[model samples]
Target: MREDAVKEGDKAPDFELERQDGGLFRLYELLKEKNVVLYFYPKDNTPGCTKQACEFRDQYEAFARLGAEVVGISSDTLESHQKFEAVHHLPFTLLSDKGGRVRSLYGVPRKLLLLPGRVTYIIDQTGTVRYVFDSMNKPLEHVSTALEVLKTISHERNTQNV
Candidate 1:
């Protein structure tokens, strides 16, 4: 990660992109409602990407129950994301990063100086980035790790109000 990269405890940088459905999605807007599991993948339809997405899909309901939303992003086109989402029956939002601007904002590093890196950020409803996991090889870990963090956040919030 770069020195200016969004880090844990920092307020997540707000941005908008064209979603799979062609609607504008702003991070700050989403932060108003639920904690976000904002993940950045390399591309669409690739084997690893597919499995990572499906892992999120399989755990979609659990994320919702924990008051978190799962969102995937990449430099792929809206059309490509639409196809990938339908083919995999992905139940979450997929955003098209036209020129990798958002990825750059988050300082998502590239793998082997070629491929875009796989990274996941857990941002709470208050817009603070609670956690970040950047692993090029562990796609499935993104889902499980994010869920664990969200569960902890939920527990903390409940205890805070008690």
Candidate 2:
């Protein structure tokens, strides 16, 4: 397994992936104005992935209140992502890593029988990764954890810059 594919204080690698909404999503461009939660999952409409996506959807407002945007990336196509979003009412961008290039760049390991493991990267507004949560627990919990980490990082940054 590739360890520490990304770390705190390191500039996040940029990418332009296709979004479910039929547009391009440039990582750096999106991070230009706000923090982002980039999650990589295995497939669309899977049990675990679906649960996690819905969790993010339910807490979409909370993430926004903290000036953070959640974006999910997977090896699935944009069409699959679109269907998943429409079915779940997900209020976030789902990026298509059709070639798995982004996944490889992020060093997300393949799971049993060639599946993408669950990995979440919490990046700050300046494009530095602040936290990474790699877990397959209830997807909702990951959103909460990301929010908590963002709040903590934001608070610390403000205090230091004061």
Candidate 3:
């Protein structure tokens, strides 16, 4: 892991970017309401990226039930993201990071030093990163790993309230 990479328990670096719908998405604004399943992918229409987005869409309800929102970030343009969401029937926010600025903030490593790495960060409502999973070759695992971590965060929160 990169020494500068944001790790578990670190405060999530806040960022704002254009969403697919052409509206600004501010991370801290959303974190005020629910936990976030924030994923960084390389591209919009690529095979691995598509599979990862669809998996998140399929399990979206589970994430919401745990008081979380799914958000995907990539260097893809808003127009591309709009098309990608329409094609995949994605039911979450897609943020466009034109220059990989947010990706850099998270220290998301690149695959083979060429393609952007696939990574997932599970952030709680308070804006603290609870977990992070990095696996460029296992796109599907990103969704599963996020679900598991969200479940654990939910369980821990419930226990704390008791």
Candidate 4:
């Protein structure tokens, strides 16, 4: 496997992309409000990607309760994302990274250096990457791992306040 270009404690590379609704989503802008769960998947409507998206969708409320926003990114076009969102009833924002520029920027290594990689990044409000989970085969594990990391971060913050 290729080494990840970004890692925990690194400042997440900022990006702006067109969301499914055609509105631009700036990474730093979203970071100002809440922690961001940014996930990259291979394609829209594919079995693994669909399962991963729905898993994130199912756990979205839990994430929000913990002050995190879930955002998905793919090389798929905005229209494809729109249909994917609607069809899956995904509540979170899906961004279009048409050329996989954002993915490449993050150094999300492609599976076998061919297919797009599956990776999840948990970035704190300050725009630092708190955690990263990368696995092409274990799609659903991304949701569980991200939630665990967020909960840990929340707990740490709470303890620090006391």
Best by lDDT: 1
Candidate 4: residue pairs that collide: none
Please give the CA lDDT of all the candidate structures: 0.94, 0.86, 0.93, 0.92
Ranking by TM-score: 1, 3, 4, 2
lDDT tens digits by residue: candidate 4, 21-85? 88889999999989999999999999999999999999999999899999999999889999999
**Model 1: runs farther than 4 Å from truth?**
none
Stretches of model 3 off by over 4 angstroms after superposition = none
Candidate 4 overall Cα lDDT vs. reference? 0.92
In angstroms, the error of model 1 at 48 is 0.9
Q: Extract clashing residue pairs from model 2.
A: none
Best by TM-score: 1
Per-residue lDDT tens digits for candidate 2, residues 1-162, read 468477667788999977887888899998888899999988899888998998899889988988899999998888898899899999899999988899888877776747787889999888888887777655667788998998897788789999
Show pairs that collide, candidate 3: none
lDDT of 1 by residue, 1-162 (tens): 878888999888999998899889999998989999999999898989999999999999999999999999999999999999999999999999988899999989889888999999999999999999999889999999999999999999999999
Q: Tell me how many residue pairs clash in candidate 4.
A: 0
